[model samples]
Target: MRTSAREVAVTAELNLSQVRALEVLLEEGHFGRAAQRLHVTPSAMTQSINRLERDLGVRLVNRTRHPVVATPAGQRFMHQAVRALEASRAAVEAARGVGAGLLTIGFIDGYSQAESRLLDRFHSENPDVRAEYRQLHWEDQVAALVDGAVDVSFARPPHSGVDTRLLDTRVVTVEPRVAVLAQHSALAQRESLTLDEIDELEVVTSATAPAEWTRWWVIDPRPSGQAVRYGPAVSTIHEAVASVRTAADSGSGHVLITGESVGQRASNAGVVFVPLVDAEPCRIELCTRRSDHRPAVQMLRALADAACSARAKTGRSVQRGAEPGVGVK
Candidate 1:
């Protein structure tokens, strides 16, 4: 009869750090990143792997590959390691004894103020579930939630694979989509803008954001349904706002239509946010996976809905023609 490798590992004196390092290494597929994730040097990760292999009495990783892969024995070890790591997290949470544990939440840009209030509300409402926040890009937040890296996502992914059931979503706040033009631009002084008037200007968007979402945000249709002019792509909201500011004073200027929620926070003297009287509202959804309806997640959802209700009281819904092209860009 052959001795079980799991039993051997138990007797071999593997520590938590070594097991965790291996788990991260496997997940990232590289030493440098694994070390970075653990906030340690690559040399430290190397030593951990060395110590683990010596204790296990096997070459657990195939180093011949550019990014390492687990050997057959290593794979078996990893299967057990994952369960062990999860058990450890569960134990730690249990020890915290109610709301003492941390819930990691993620947010993309443009929702800092609303998120701040929501966090305050969460603790006030449920002091036991401590929360932490991370800033992620539009695409990264969706991926993070799918991988279980983030417990809750503050904004629904504007675009993802067609599995609507993947997320349990609640509308937090719906912002009136508004056009921001450089104050010096031809249409800057307008109190409100028509869809046709908006299409005449060069509309700016984050170049890297999903095009479908961006087009919808900027009101890409000219009322006649022709694609409106797209201006230079700004990589971020800050950059987009700065471009509008520059346009207010520069020879070249562009207009941008985005959520009033964020544009309201921006204080650039050169840019102005005017209501898009006839465009669909931009919906901001607080979402968690369908499988992750934990008490903590449910609490956040409830708080978000409360926030939405408050916002609705002060907010006037705005829309004119066909629903905006896509979604939050």
Candidate 2:
């Protein structure tokens, strides 16, 4: 009789740990060491090894041998056991890559604090899903998404490896650019500063950051036609802040041009954040993988859209982020 796929009944699973113990025992050539390999008591190993042989209805090991050599039947079973473990590992790894109930989000420097409301909403809608956030450089965010490390990201767009083709965005808010300087600097007294004043100071920028991103963040294109002078190269926002403090104390006058919101989070007592009222707007985009069609992605997008819409009715600039600058940390 021919059996359909639906008619085939699968039996309860074999214990993989016991099978692994058997394999390790065969490889190690000792009972005490095999027990140590599996982190089990020697008695437990004896029980499991016995149970495994009994389950198969065959004598696996030659108990008379002091070294415990495998019987011919056990030797034959060893090959199949190896294949079984490989198949089990392959299935598990493939399933993990699918990202079923896991929702991963990447954010640039300060955006994590901005997206809390949306996250709260997302958790409310899908309480069973595990939500994780990775804080990344402006350049690394998109690459993280394309590599499947993250399902969505809150970051600036047009990244090198992951451009419009690899990602889609939902605009949460747009913010003005700001110049960060030492509080003691003469320019810090002013409520607002223009790009020309920023151009006069040596620009402190990141060495490890992507060129295009650094150019944009530091206002590479100047109001004055003179070539911009690059000051020091830093690796992180914390490092940038440290440099700003150093320059402030020394009166060397180093400046960092960054988004208004990021300036707030990264600013300290020594750093004064002054709005560059005329600089181009910094768009805070909700970036998600274009090919992903998971429930968590859809739910997050919906929550962001609702949040943006509600904020629009109030005629407010995105404060902090879409809501507030301090991150969950």
lDDT values, one for every candidate = 0.70, 0.69
What residue runs in model 2 are displaced by over 4 Å at the alpha carbon? 1-94, 97-99, 311-329
Q: Roughly what TM-score does model 1 have, to 2 decimal places?
A: 0.63
Residue-wise C-alpha lDDT for candidate 2, range 1-329, written one tens digit per residue: 86543332111125777777786677556789778746799999999888887667677888788767789988988756766655564355347746447766787675634576677767887888887777776556666665456778887633533234446677676667777888888898898988887777888887755566677677666668767888888877777877877987876888877777788788687788888887776767787766555667777777777767776788864532231211000
* Clashing residue pairs found in predicted model 2: 320-324
Q: Please list the Cα RMSD from the true structure of every candidate, rounded to 1 decimal place.
A: 7.8, 15.6
Question: Candidate 1, which ten residues in sequence have the lowest lDDT sum?
Answer: 316-325
Provide the global lDDT of candidate 2 against the true structure: 0.69
Which candidate gets the maximum TM-score versus the true structure? 2
* TM-scores of all candidate predictions against the true structure: 0.63, 0.64
Error of 2 at 194 (Å): 0.9
Number of colliding residue pairs in each model = 3, 1
Screening candidate 1 with a backbone cut-off below 3 angstroms (N, C-alpha, C), the clashing residue pairs are 99-128, 99-129, 278-320
Which candidate leads the pack in lDDT? 1
Model 2 error, position 181 (Å):
0.6
Query: What TM-score would you give candidate 2 relative to the actual structure?
Result: 0.64
Tens digit of lDDT per residue, candidate 1, span 1-329?
86688887685544877887887787567899778767899999999999889878999899888778899999988776766655554455445535335687887774646667887877887877767788777555554664456777876336442234456777665667788778777777888887787666677876656555665666555566867778878776778888878765658768777778778777577778888888877766777766554577778878877776776677743221123345224
Alpha-carbon RMSD, candidate 1: 7.8
